[model samples]
Target: MREDLRYLLSTFTARDRFLLVMVVLAQFTSALLDLVGIAVVFPLMQALTGASLEGGILGRLYDVLGGGSRERFTIVLALIMILAFLAKAVLASIILWWSSGIVVRLQTTTSRRLLQHYLTEPYLRHRDRNVGEVISAVGQGAQMAHTSVLGGLLQVLSQAMSIGLIAVFLLVVAPLPTLAAIAYFAIVVFGLQRALAPANRKAGLEAQNAAWASSHALVDSLHGFRELTMHDAQGFFVDRFDVANVSQAQSARRANFLAMLPKSVLELTTMAAIALLVILSVATGSEAAALPTLSLFVAASIRILPSMVALTATLGTIKVGRAGLEVVVRALQEALTSGVDDQDPRTTAALPVTEAPIEVQQVGFRYPGAGRDVLRDVTLRIPNGSSLALAGPSGSGKTTLVNIILGLIPPTSGSVTYGDVPVRQSDQWWHDVVAYVPQDVYVADDTLAGNIAFGVPEDQRDDELVRRSADRALLGDLLAELPDGLETRVGERGSRLSGGQRQRVGIARALYRQPQVLVLDEATSALDNETEHRMTETIRSLHGEITTIIVAHRLSTVRHARQLAFLADGRVEAVGTFNEVVSASPRFARLVALGQLDLQEGPESA
Candidate 1:
């Protein structure tokens, strides 16, 4: 716990430290009012019994209240008590409201910073971490810290203040018994912490495990819902979820039981002490002494025991909070250590005016945990105003190469250049010029215009431009059919649209950027032959206007490219016009034999 505190303290920025101080001071002020309430209890009691204090603190309190009839005095005292209660209530309310808002804001800020870091950080960092876990940890960490750390600290302070007041009053009354009671309470709290520490740790781990398991189940279910429904496997998923829920419940129950044990023991010990005090007061010498002693013992015990109970509960919360703090601290550490000094050089103000030729020079890359390179010593030059096609079997590094070109992955060796400048170092230049249509089209749960303008700035999104891009990508007819036209909401992932329509929407999205270079990675795989043919014609029509790179599985699409390259394993096997590569490379000849290439052999081949 001490180590956790030290670590948490280290994460606080200067501004956070200031907020911490303000929260602490507010809590202390509230606690002081509670202590004052306890102090007033003794004077009220003495006044009720017709006992007058000649010169002590109670005497001063009596003089301050002023002489009056019993009814008038009661009224005055009630008003003062009411005012004090109101003041404390106001303070508590403000503290609680502000704390809750601050926690929410802080969590939002943390999550936003995390997202920015995720986008700007190196690709390898994402591969090393879990996205779902990072988000969950940030959310839960802020909630727990606010509730347990800040709230528990306030509770403990309130309890400590009450104990302090009781101790001071005890000095004027039964000192020995008061000391003994305090000692007993402290011992019980310490015992509770010792016993529950392991339980808190175990419970925290179980909670995190259950969260991950549930999230994994949800992701799997969504991805494979169709298959599951066809197989009638609802019971299987339900059973899996039940296992996680039950494990979480059992762990919580155990932790609660452990936390309660010491408080119960402390309460039993308190009752024994109260009983002994009562007996001693009743048996002792004079009635005056006996009455006051009993009153002091009862008042002090009542005040102090409640505080002890609160502290015991607070101790458990603080322990659990310590566990949550670890997750938050780990996430912050990761974000700070990402070393993204050269990640992206793009700025919104400086947009690329035209596309430049893209060149991959002796680049090589391998996935983490994989033994061999997915792309190796690969070199290619796609000049501006030309269309090129990459043809390959599955696992021939087609997607891997595209990822490198898009700046999604960095090469392990060599570099990619646009014109003469390194692509990574010229992010803004490349971003405005290059657009990608990925194999898996992502249609957001938003309007048609929104999905097309996913990366476009709001101030730049024009309705006319959106319509123009739609027409260019052949999605204008589809949009015209929608009830709201461009304003119509697309269902999640465009599940309402046919596969070809979704693909066209994706193409329109890329075209919306008005990019100088457009890369399509099997973008037409979802469309039928006629749709594919139309889309290919639309792409070919762009011709000298933009540089185009297409990864195609269909022979018909590959034949349209001015140049074609066949990739085998992790290297280029052949590159030339259709006949040049077909005659020179046997690998190309086999591809033709396997019907992987469309040859212009007959008059009907058109």
Candidate 2:
């Protein structure tokens, strides 16, 4: 728990810490004002009742205020009390403003840091985790930090301060009674905490787990809504989500009930204690002399009892939120130790413009915790300004090989290089020279020009470059069809565009970077015949100008490539021109015979 608290505090900046200190000071000041206000009540009451004020600070103040008649003294004391409370109100507002501001900043800052960390981590890390869980951790986890850690801490501190200062004032006014009251409240708080600790902790843990589960289920249901509706399986998701939501609500209810329980018990105890004090004062025959002091003690208790109750409530809330704090702390620690470089100087640097060949030398790759290599001894060369088509059946490691060549992942053995330089050492320069279009193109809900000029800053976006790239990607006709040309809005994930149009947007995005190497991982497989032909023509035009690597299951897409490589069982079966591969490898010939390559015409015709 101590370690978790330390980590939570570490997330705050120096400025935040300073603001926290100011809030604490403001709380203390408010407590002091409350004590002063309660103290004034005694003098005002004494003046109203015509009691002697012959000693103490009130007597001295009475003398200073002309030692006036009781009515005038009462008015003066009442005005002072009002002013003190008014000042306290202002201080209370300041405390609230600062504390709320801190909580908001923590939520936003932690969420941003988590997102940036996720983005900077290696690609494999992303693949190995559940996307729904990641989303939950970043989105809901941040809200938990705000409600559980920062807000809880501030509440506990301010309430505790108020209770402490008020108790001290009571002790000064009536030591014996104050001590007795303190001891009784202490025993009650301790006993209640002991009784409720296990239940609170259990409820908190349950709530945290249920929250994550519900969030994950909801995201999954939304992302797969089309599939669910088509298959009549929406009830499955709804049932799953219903169970999680009910559990979360139950746990929250249990925790909140426990947190509020202390207020009721404290209120009863306070009324009984006040009644007992009054009876004892009257029974001892000291009622006349003790009335002023008794009133003072009773007034202090009236203020202090509520503070004690609030303190207890805040403590209960903290216990209920402990599990959430632990989860957030663990996430932060993992991000810090994940071995991903958060700051890479090369991200903003200029890339080399000279073209170079990419070479793969006996590269083998086994996925983490996998039993066998996905790619073994895969050696290939993509010469500068030449197109290569990587052909393979499913699970034959074509995509893995392309990933290695693109430097997205390191090989388990051997090396991949660009000319004489290792790809990893080039850092962002490698990415700057290469653009990748995946099978599923991601289109943002943005303007057509914005999607095409994706990563470029809005102020730096060049309309001319967008037009040129769109033309090269064969999107000119699509743009003409749009009512707003480049300014047309693509719906979320490009729902506004056809599959072929989305693919063209992906192509235009890659071309806008003016990459030396363009990689298409089954980019044309989703398009219709005519659209695929157009896309293939676009690739053909770049054949001699930019190095192109195409991983294709459709044979027609790669039929015109300068070189072809066939892979099977994690090994390269053959590498040559298409005709040479077909003549040399029986497996390649079999695939062609079985029509697995989806040829428009016979192999001999190609």
Candidate 3:
């Protein structure tokens, strides 16, 4: 356990290392002030007993203040003591305030780093991880790190100073009792440390597992809630979630019960020690010769006990915090190591590409952990100023092909070329030149203008250009109808708008970028016939200006394209003009014969 903590703290960055040092130093200062406060009890006792402060730590402080004036120095000594007490209070408050700020900064940095890594990691990494695990690491990990850093450093300082001060006073008054207190505290802390290590490890695993399970249950059920309701399986999901939560609660309770054991023992041991000291002081008549010694002993015990208790509590918390931080450190290390192969591969600027178009050559891909390839031996070319429509049956790998082009997923074999350069290390390359509109459009809960210009730089955005794009997308009239025009808020996922309106907003977002390559993955399938026709008209108008790839289910949507490719069984069946493929391929001919091509047409027209 101690080794784990050493590794965790040592692994912190240089800035964090310096912060830790400052926290420990501040804690030491606060501890010194507390010890100084404890020293006051001895002088107050002497005043009550009519004894003189002639030979003690306080007496020395007084002599230094008085310059050897033994007589009539009490008044001056009293005033000086009061000033010293106030000074200690002020200094302690300052250190505590500083430590609090340090802790805030530490947690803030931790949260930002984790969130950045999460956003930038490759898509496959997220596929294997649970949303809950990532969320828990960022949320709960920050809180625990903040608390442990502050509590651990402060207590270590407080307890060590208090023990040292009390031990010195006890030795001066009586050696045997001092030795006994030191021995007792050492054993208690050691035993507490030993007993808590296993529990800490267990708690870390439990938190991770429970968070992951809960997240899976929540996301899966919500995403598939309609399906589950149709199949009457909602009760089953609830039962599973309940079981997971109950098991996690039980594990937490057990861990808590184990942590409390050390405190119970320390409390009982402290009470016994105090009783023994009182008995010895009375029986041996040590109070008569140096009755003030009893006050010093009592004062030291009073001050030291709370510090020791705080130390024990924080030690337990530190153990748990260290375990949690190990998880975070491992995640950060993985992020650093996993996605570093892209350096010096390729570069795509934010500005438009002046090179030739993209070409795919013999690209083969299979999902990780899957038994069969989704796309096999695929070869295709998209010219600089021509559009290609991908017409395929469901499960025919159209989405996988799109994902490859976007750099969201890497191919298992073969290479993709942009102009004459092989696509490599092109981070956000698609964003640089390609604007993608997926099947399910994402709508932000912000102004209509904000959703349309999602990726455009604020300073570069021209309102006139944005308005033209909206008109091209057939969404100009809708935005004008709203009270705030383009500034009106769209509800979550554009829930307030019709399906066709939402699809138009998505089209506007894509067109706003003025991308060189625009890929529409069934983006307009949700729209009505009129809206779909308008969208296709606008798309065809930019045929030479932008290279477009449309994944189409409705053949009517692709009749205007220069070329059409029919995909079936994860391979390209045929590629040619609409009538050419229908005449050559029986699958295409059957679809045409059945009038499925004109799905938007009424039955009477068919």
Candidate 4:
């Protein structure tokens, strides 16, 4: 627990730590003021009851003020008590504002850090983890951990101090009643802790799991909504989400009951204690003799009882939030432990990446925990200006090889180098040199120009460059049809655009980067046959200008490439021209017959 707390705090920035300190001081200040406020009532009560104020510090103050009437002195003490409460209220407001800063800072900062960690993870890590789990951890888990766990801790600290200071003040006023009240509340708190702590912790963990489940069900189902509707299985996802939500609600209900139980239990038990103290006081002495003590006790109870209930509730809430805290801590620890290949990804940016062949040297890769290599002894080279078509049957390590060459995944037993320098050494410049377009293009909710110039600020975008890139991707038709042309809003996730249009936008995005190495990972798969032909021509036009690597299931897409690497299973069976590959591998011959490679008008492969 200690180690986890330290790790959690380490994620907080120095500014957040300073804000936390201010909150602590505010709580302490509020508690101290409460003590003063409660303590002042005792003197005021004594003065109102006609008790002699001619001997103590009150008498000295009265004498210093020319022995004012008892009424004026009583009024002065009452005013001081009012001022203290007023000050506390104002300070409480300020503390709330400061507390919000810490929570927001912690949530936003930690969420961003986790996001960066996930984004920078090697590609295989993404493959191994569930998308919804990562989504929940980065968004929901982060918010809950900050709002509940850290906020609950603050509540506990603040209330505990209030109780302690008030208890001390009460002890001085009436020792026996104070002692009995303290003992009783302590017993109740201890009993409640034992009864509710395990349940609260369990409920918290249950809530976390339910959140994960519901998040997974919702996101996964929404993404596959079309398929679910076609299969008439929408209720399956609905039921799954309902079950998770029901569990989440049940856990929250249990926690609420536990928190509320203390308030009532403490209320009745405290009222009983106060009544007994009053009865004993009156029975054992005259009412006049007991008035001052009774009055003091009543005032103290008014302040202390609520703090005690709040302290108990706060403790229970902290237990509930502990589960989320554990989740957040584990995620952060994983991100830390699974270090990136490039310690500082930008450190080698200044080292120039010379235009030379991209070399794959004795490369062998096996996914983590896999038994065999996906690519074994794979040696290949693509000169500065050449196109290599990665062709294979499904699951032939074609995509993996593309990823390895693109530095998205590192080979387990080999290294890729650019112009004799290791790729890892020039990762930043490597990124600037390469641009990739996946099979399913991701379009953000932005204007057409913004989508083409993805991640570029609106003010910094070059209108002409956006237009040129879009034209290169054959988006002229799309641009002309749009009412607002380049400025038209693309709906969320490109909901307004067709799949092929989004793919074209992705192509245009890659083109906008003006990269030297272009990787199209089944990038044109969504296009119609005619569109694919045109795009293939566009790709062919870039021959000997931009070194292009393409992974394609369609033979027409790779018909005119300079080189072809045909893979079978996880091995590269042949690396040569189209006719040479067809002669070398029977699979290529079969593909040629199936795809009618010779029927297409194309240049002879290099």
Candidates in order have lDDT scores of 0.72, 0.83, 0.72, 0.84
For residue 289, what is the lDDT in candidate 2? 74
Predicted candidate 4 versus true structure: per-residue lDDT over 204-298, tens digit per residue: 88988888888888888888978999999999999998999899899889989988889998889878887887788778876777787788778
Compared to the true structure, candidate 4 yields what TM-score?
Answer: 0.95
Instruction: Give the alpha carbon lDDT tens digit for every residue of 64-130 in model 1.
Output: 7885665555566556656765787798789878766655565566556556666676656666767
Error of 1 at 126 (Å): 2.6
- Tell me the deviation in Å of residue 374 in model 2: 0.9
Estimated TM-score for each candidate: 0.89, 0.93, 0.87, 0.95
Location of the lowest summed lDDT over 10 successive residues in candidate 3: 597-606
Candidate 1 versus the native: TM-score?
0.89
Number of the top candidate by TM-score? Answer: 4
Worst 10 residues of 2 by lDDT: 597-606
After TM-score superposition, what is the CA distance of residue 25 in candidate 1 from its true location, in Å?
0.6
lDDT of 3 by residue, 379-487 (tens): 8888886888888779989888888877777889877776766654235555667788988888877778878888555676677777877898998779768998887
> lDDT by residue for model 2 over 185-236, one digit each (tens)?
8998898888888888898788878888898789889888789999999999
lDDT score, candidate 4, position 206: 90
> For model 1, which pairs clash?
none
Candidate 1 Cα lDDT to native: 0.72
**Candidate 2 deviant stretches above 4 angstroms:** 64-66, 339-347, 596-606
Off by over 4 Å in 1: 1-13, 65-79, 127-132, 149-174, 255-272, 285-287, 290-297, 300-304, 340-354, 425-429, 455-460, 596-598, 601-606
Off by over 4 Å in 3: 1-13, 43-62, 67-86, 149-158, 165-174, 221-265, 340-352, 424-426, 455-463, 596-606
